[model samples]
Target chain A: MAQLTFRESIARGIAQEMRRDESVVFLGEDVGAAGGVFKGTVGLLEEFGGIRVRDTPISEQAILGAAMGAAMTGLRPIAEIMFSDFFAVCWDIVANEIAKSRYMTNGQMSFPLVIRSGNGGGLRFGAQHSQSVENWAMMIPGLKVVVPSNAVDVIGLMAASIRDNDPVVFLEAKSLYSSKMDVPDGDIVDTLGSAKVLRQGSDATLVALGAMVPRALDAAEELATNGINCTVVDVRSLVPLDTATILREVSATGRLFTVEENPRLCGWGAEVTSIVADEVFYDLDGPIVRITTPHIPLPAADALEDLAIPSVERIVTTIHKSMNS
Target chain B: MASTKVAPAQSDVAQKIAMYKSQFALRQFETRAYDLFLENYVKGTSHLSIGQEAIAAGVAAAMRPTDWTFATYRGHAHTLARGVPMTPVFAELMGRTNGLMAGKGGSMHLTSVEHGVMGSYAIIGAHLPIACGAAWSAQYRGTDQVAVAFFGDGSVNIGAFHEALNFAAVWKLPVIFFCENNLWMEYTRTSDVTAVVNPAADRASAYGLESIIIDGNDADEVYEVTSRAIARARAGDGPSMIEAKTYRHGGHSRADPGKYRPAEEIAEWMAKDPIPRYRLRLLESGVSESELLEIEAQVNAEVDDATEAAKAGGVPGEDLLMKDVWADGGAAWRN
Candidate 1:
């Protein structure tokens, strides 16, 4: 086993895909010489020539449009949108064109493309730059949304996303980009839509997404010391949500708490809450709780941003409240 | 394919006449489609390509059959010119089960992978970057297939148009930006809204691309201009643009009568209509009048048959709403 930072694992994962599939090419702003804003693409330009790793003008529409068009033909283009917030600039293309073209084309074309974007809010990049709007993308019907927690999951899930026969938006947690984690020694590919049970317990189930997974684990470990053991599962991909694992965990514990950075109302947490409400409501011994940020734009200040996001303390508090109430 | 260049002689003349006949067929098709839409036989509206047949027919003829094409809402002529079956084209507008898109895409979203009509975007200039992507794919896959993006004068002002052209030029993708400068961008004149005198080629040149302005109403000129660009792209010389000065005869949609257009301007363009002008060119060039009439009669019959078949076709099944929404994900992918 080798320890790798989240960003390094991303570079390794994409480099592996590009080596495996010639059709896989990387394109975006600062993806080339600048090696990506967070250095996720630090060594890609050297490994792959300019033809494969291109630095595009700051046009997200063109980037995504090219990805959609290339996917329609034979190329598997991995476009980086720099930040998930920039998805708004090409909102129509992402929401309307790329997401709907396959179904609109009647399964005649499989959009085998990946859009890697930096998401989440811990760094205090302010309102526009720091927003977790995976829920907005998840609302679109024909999209596959993936958000990984660690280096191992990021590498495997990214490779899987590149090979997926559908359009995928893989949002990397900017907060965890430098965080180091041990990944498997050799080649490892993770299955999409499969949730991993990071910890097991019977008191309650804590299903989280993106950076929230580590935080959920943190809360679980703290709860473990207090004798309130909990099960923690990384509900990785929201679109092809591992509802089977989610239902099983919730069924076993008779309680469900979804942790996320997005706002509470109608966010991804609501989707999980509704699913549990519909399918496994009888299995729950208590009401479903969602530990999420308030429904407001992310603040620029460090203190306010910290308070706005779902911290480990907040998840622990929500867990205890859900356990009792 | 035989040399795309058209000369004043035997087989070349025959190819020219073939293009002429195709333009006539598209003209007839658009006319009949508009009539059906007026009669309410075809559901929804259509942006007919009545005056812009030459650009469509010429560009489609200039490229290889395998080459991809993208267009805007005014794409019935484009699909027809690209050789999509008239039955499916008509059926698509009529929302039939056997339509080009299984009745899902309708007029604005008409598409056919087999015939190489990638998409007919309703949003102006939105498909430009997508067209660039197709070109990038062809280069990446090492295929000589070139993708053409067809849009109007209004699209030239949009950011996507600029973005796409820059990307195409920077990447040297095998794509052609065919600007159908039809003067009017849905009732508003191109000059009224745009900054330049003729928006054609100016935008392309801004992106450091080789561009040319041709008489869009002339089928032969369009074929010649687009053929050179496509050949250049195939030779790996990169992207080029052809701004074809064309006009739209009908109003923007079924609703508009186009009172905003000056009578003289519309009259001047109507005199410059591509079909009759090309017909005269063919006849003066020693092609018999009977040949032209025969082509017209044949297309007329084809349009009638298509209209009848489309009206007689069955509606989309109930599962239309449920199926094809998620090709590879959405719960089915869960393990």
Candidate 2:
């Protein structure tokens, strides 16, 4: 096993897939020689050569359109949209073309492509760059949404996204790029629709995705000392949701708390809360609570940004208050 | 700008006859589609390629079977030209069980990969970059196949059009961006909306490509020009932009009466209808009138057979609604 940062794991995971498949090619702005805008793709250009790894212009529509066309033909292309917010510029292509192509074509075309972007806040990049946009992708019917919280999950999920025969929107938490984890050497793959239970508890279930997973875990540890034991469930795949794991954990805990970085309105938490409220209503001992950012733009200031996104302190306080009440 | 492409060979009588048949098939198909729409047999809306058959027929004749073709929402002619059986095309238009896409994609999204009709995109200018991507795949795989995208004059104003042109030029992709300049963008005149006189060809220089314009009503011209462009692409000379000047005899969609056009202008273009002109050319070139009569009879019979077959098809099954949404052939998002 070797210690790899989340950003390093992005490159490692892509390299693992590209090395395995000759048809796999990667492209985006500054993704080739400049090693990606986030420096997550440092060695891909040199290792794979320009043919396999390419740097495109500042054309989001063209980048995604090319990826879709390439995927429809033969190549399994990975196109990076530098920031998750940039999806708005090319939302028509993503929401209309790539998402619906296979179904609209009645399975005549299989889009084995991945569109990865640095998502969510922590760098104080303000509203445009830092806002979590997983909800935008999740609402689309034909897309498979994935967000990995840590280095190991990032590598595993990236591999799964590349291999899957559907169009996948891989959201990399920008906040966790610097975080490190010990990853096993060689190719590591993970299932697309499985949620991982990091901590086992019975009092409450803390469901989180992307950057919120780590915060949920941290809050669980603090809540354990306060006599409020909690279970942390990492929602790795949002589309092919492992509702089995979520329902099982939520049922066991009898109380559900969703830690979301996105805005509160119609967030992923609301859907999960709705599902729990419908399926296992009698199993609940307490009301379900969602801890999320307010329905407002993320601020650029360090203090304001920290307050906007769900932090460990916020998760602990929200869960504790709900449990006590 | 001068046309930089090498002059193409003179089409033989056999090739001319084939082009005539292709155009005849398209004209009949569109005429029948409009009739179906009026009779309420075709639901929603359909954009017909009535007078613009020459561009589609010519491009399809010039293209190899392995080459890919992308068309706009008004793509019935392009789809039919690729030799996708008329019955399935008509069935899709009528939203039948045996439709090309099993009625999943209606008239606007005809896709028959086996026939090299990649797809018919509804969005303006979206398929240009997609065609570039397909060309990129062909190049990457060393397939020597080319991708052709057909759009209207309006798409030139869209962002994707410029981006795709530049991307294809930069990458040296084997793709052709064909613009069927029907002189109007929806209800508006192309000249009133577009800055350049030739929407597509005028912008070719910006992407370091040659500017070439052809008479879209002339099937022979479209076949020769596109053949040259396709050969250049296969030879790895990169992309080409062709603006085929034509006019739509009907409205943009089934709803419009096309009163926006001037009576004189409509009369002028209607006189140059590609079918009759091609027929006259054949007769003047010493071709027997009986030969032309035979082609007309065949096209009429084919259209009749296709319409009958399409009308006989049943509604799609309920299970198909959730199928094909994912690769596993199920739309289950959660367990």
Candidate 3:
């Protein structure tokens, strides 16, 4: 019941699960002696030792393929790919191998595997490092994608992802890792395929994911004084999306403003926009708006990188414009 | 780059005939599958291992019933050698309800975990790391089970191949990297593609793994090498890299005439056809020549029956299309 940072929550969640289940193993580059480059795996090697908490070579293909194999053969391995950008190298492994094995086997195979990676922008690591590519995974069937916006969801979703039968890509928001938030004590597992309404409102719906939720909440806080009550929703697990909650929220408020770190076009926000137009077309009072990074590579320049991603001010302005339109 | 992996051993006549029979069955099975595929008997494509039957037979023979195996798209021989029934294999190829994937995975993606043929990868080099993981699982569980991966020379350059080799070596995983170096990477030869010497055995040193090159067409050679490697793996001596130097008799897939391959090279390999070579070897060892032909006749009959069963194997029920998309009750389908 104490405050834990997002990184701490993930480490604790993984540690807790590893302790509870003997089949659970943590394998990744620098996951052992280095305790993970981001420190999310800090105390695991000491607690679980080298056997359970393994340090693997820097190979995304092996990390994913081996994890898929391990999962197929009874053990539940939690594999950590350092950056979401590196998932590019593992496109075939994930899109084809891990994601399709279960169905290809006629449901005979169970891939109780979790692939965790650091995602999103704002620290200015540039194009190669800063990218939220959940869309790549969400586009694939059988692979569940989860983006935790806060420490609480991180712990809850991380636990649930590990226990899930299908392969899950758990993205830990890089910026949110240092931010501290209070989480419930004991085993806290949440349902996947459901979105949580962080703030309820009636004027317009603000659908945000992972890192954008905090910024969306910030925009909501500022919008409150202007008499624009915005409902900020965290679309936690994007694949098995919480369409019911989204449709209901959009139905209540005819305006929808979706936000995320990835490019707006063909992103999760656009998917949400299409869902709104397709399902509840007549319910719209204004144009569906998506506030996101432009379709370009993220730059190393700090200010330009900030310009590329969505911000609190940007989200608020978009909300106001959507309300006006 | 080379070692004494092919040590001499006393060969029993029964064991020799049994190995030869499996290879004979694979040659017949691939030929039948191809014939049916060309005549529109089965939908989609299939990568045949017609010339490389010995590698599969020997590898399957060396593996324990509980040991796992991940193979490439040209995995018919591997799967059949695992002793998976021809009905399911044919049923899968024909897109039938009782098929391995219940008509979903055609030919490129056939999986029969019950027989320990852990789904063949359509993408080359893709299954290498997965085999390492299975080995990792066995190691984690404290079991002596081993995971074997079979890929062609084309897959050696792929990232998974190198990664799996390194991971298996560092982790001391009980696995085998069985490279079926047919010389060509799909349409191109390995000589044209990469600069590494000894395309098979030379790559093992990079991963610090024990490696050997064997005549892939010889069932006894494949059996001897893989058995020793499998023994080392089961004894926790770590992974081994065995490159079986075989040749692909036909084109890479359906409609490929393989004109790109030189006629003389083809003739040379054709003369060294594994099935006949093994048959002659058995006869020379005083085993009955009629006995070998009888075995081949039985295999031919089995192939004919399998072909009939596969044709009658119907497509899955419509309701089944939605099944296995996710675990039942894991999440709700959009209403």
CA RMSD of each candidate after superposition? 2.9, 1.1, 1.6
Q: Please give, for residues A149-229, the per-residue lDDT of candidate 1 as tens digits.
A: 999988899999998888899999899998998887776689888989999999999999998999999999998888888
Better structure of 2 and 3 per lDDT:
2
DockQ of each: 0.66, 0.89, 0.67
RMSD of 1: 2.9
Error of 2 at A146 (Å): 0.6
lDDT against the true structure, each candidate: 0.87, 0.93, 0.87
Give the Cα-based TM-score of candidate 1 against the true structure.
Answer: 0.96
Better of 1 and 2 by TM-score: 2
Best by lDDT: 2
Worst 10 residues of 2 chain B by lDDT: B1-10
lDDT of 3 by residue, B1-335 (tens): 46555766355778888899999999888888988887887877788998999889888888889998888888888988998989889889888887878887778887889999998998878898899999999999999999999888888777778888898999999999888988888898888987775575788888887568889999888888888899999999999998888899998888687889999999999998898898888888898978877988999999988888877877687576777877662334342
Model 3 C-alpha RMSD vs. true structure (Å) is: 1.6
Give lDDT: candidate 2, residue B221: 86
lDDT of 3 by residue, A166-201 (tens): 789999889888999888889888888889998988
Candidate 2 positional error at B5, Å: 8.8
Worst 10 residues of 1 chain A by lDDT: A101-110
What is candidate 2's lDDT per residue for A240-325, written digit by digit as tens?
99999999999998999999999989899999999999999999999999999999999999999998999999999888888888
